[model samples]
Target: MMIHGFHSSRQDFSFGPWKLTVAKMHVMKSANVEKLADELHMPSLLEMMFGDNVLRIQHVSGFGIEFNATYALKCVNNYPGVLKVACAGEWEESRTMGEHYKEIIRPYDWTYTTDYKGTLLGKALKLKVVPMTDHIDTEKLKAREQIKFFEEVLLFEDELHDHGVLSLTVKIRVMPSSFFLLLRFFLRIDGVLIRMNDTRLYHEADKTYMLIWAIQGLR
Candidate 1:
């Protein structure tokens, strides 16, 4: 299922045991307004730390099941060359069933890591800003495509299940150059996978861009 407009105010969908509803979508743009004001007078520490050119998309969603996906972006030291993208989330069922379901998924063990640097798909997963490339083609790079990229490229699954044997999985992707980040939340119950949310963020030369898709289904 594909949604056509960014102006859509509300949408609802469901699959299997999962149901999703989305509302109140809007875009926001911001610059270093505080920094500009500080420069005219005396600057404080907080004002000096402000960076310019930020764009964000805000939306609300309701999932029949409890679910969340979040990402944090941080600069490596004081240098802008490298950035770190960290992701984490949780899921819980409406009711508890048995001991078997409780132990289905465990907390993320950060001691292990995988390197996808060698394969063809791995190489393509790294997104870098090309000086003159037309990177904002919404037609070629749809919201769904950006979401699917992580599921195909990076492998990160930390899940938990409940009494009904319903499972929740989280996947994350961080580009090598720190230009892009993607997070996906998935719910699996009765041997079927339902995508709950897809969120993507891009840091470009002049601005930060965000795109999101929240989905749910009903019986």
Candidate 2:
């Protein structure tokens, strides 16, 4: 089975210098699809879509990041070369899209695997992307501290026409000592393979710099 989208009844969250917003509107209607197509100029979007799922995490005077469907799909097309993936006749949407759309998708990965790390925001912030020589304190995050606020937001998702699942999601948990946020892109192609891309962010209430680490895996 497949799901178009889901709704989250919670409001935005804020802890210390961080500000978070989770927007989960219904699936894209025809008008939404048309607008996105016109704006994105990508015919591959003719398959399936969820235009309203967005998650944004910003800082008062620091670095920030955002997750949304529009940019993620854009990455799938711009991902260098064709991926060794296919849904064949299992993908109902691709089958129904006919030949013209298939031609447009032939050069791209129809499985919708995205290498999108996240859309970074804030120019004046003192955020630097150094090598992951250092790390997020796993022991601290694993501690049983008092969680002030927590929320999970689904940025976008697809069932790959019933072949498997591809989705991007972001979640954050705030504790008295510090806060942790995880943004992930996960793909499962059933018997083929499973790949995961993770971006983890951690911040201590007493520090000015936030620790960020990114990891990728395929099997």
Candidate 3:
């Protein structure tokens, strides 16, 4: 069976709320925090960025409905209260899979003194990032078996056909108080599992935020 999940609405993809949260976190203020960025809330963010109909299948063995990056970016631009798209680059041709995944983990600077610094542009982009190691150590599975497993699990299931996935589960860290992070998951089809983790900060060009990702096809 082909199982799929829904992303957030079209209005929830902006980094404004996420940026504001970071500002508050840095200032150590306890005021009421409203969610703005998709990082903190993946489902809501997905919904907002991709809409309820982002993924759908026509029939078994048929090409499923898909969403594209152009559409995804357009949705991101539609959110309310966006000061501007702080992220730099065209996103389509500018970023590659490796750079894009790196951006998702902490896409913000966890440390205060980085190139991007404390601004949303800095905080939303990734600086130095790495992919997590696959923990399955074994002589039982042949190298090709392992390779095939990972390829089926990670690369195939992800929404890569549309927009390349920027930042995956291995890098993202969700809040425990609300338990929003626990519900999130990376894609795994046959045997591959990508657990994206969130780091802090992103990379930018010419004083503008750029979408960064860290990608690995592993066994």
The lDDT per prediction is 0.26, 0.71, 0.23
lDDT of 1 by residue, 150-170 (tens): 322211222332311211223
Q: Return the TM-score for candidate 1, rounded to 2 decimals.
A: 0.24
Worst 10 residues of 2 by lDDT: 1-10
The order by descending lDDT is 2, 1, 3
Candidate with the larger TM-score of 1 and 3: 1
Report the lDDT of model 3 for residue 1: 18
Sort every candidate by TM-score, greatest first.
2, 1, 3
Q: Pick the candidate with the highest TM-score.
A: 2
List where candidate 1 sits over 4 angstroms from the true fold: 1-178, 191-193, 208-219
Candidate 1: give its CA RMSD in angstroms.
Answer: 22.9
Candidate 1 — which pairs collide?
13-216, 13-217, 14-216, 14-217, 14-218, 15-217, 20-216
lDDT (10s digit) by residue, model 3, range 35-55: 333423321122112111221
Write down the RMSD of all candidates, one decimal each.
22.9, 3.5, 20.4
Q: Candidate 2 vs candidate 3: which has greater TM-score? A: 2
Model 2 lDDT vs. the true structure?
0.71
lDDT of 2 at 148: 86
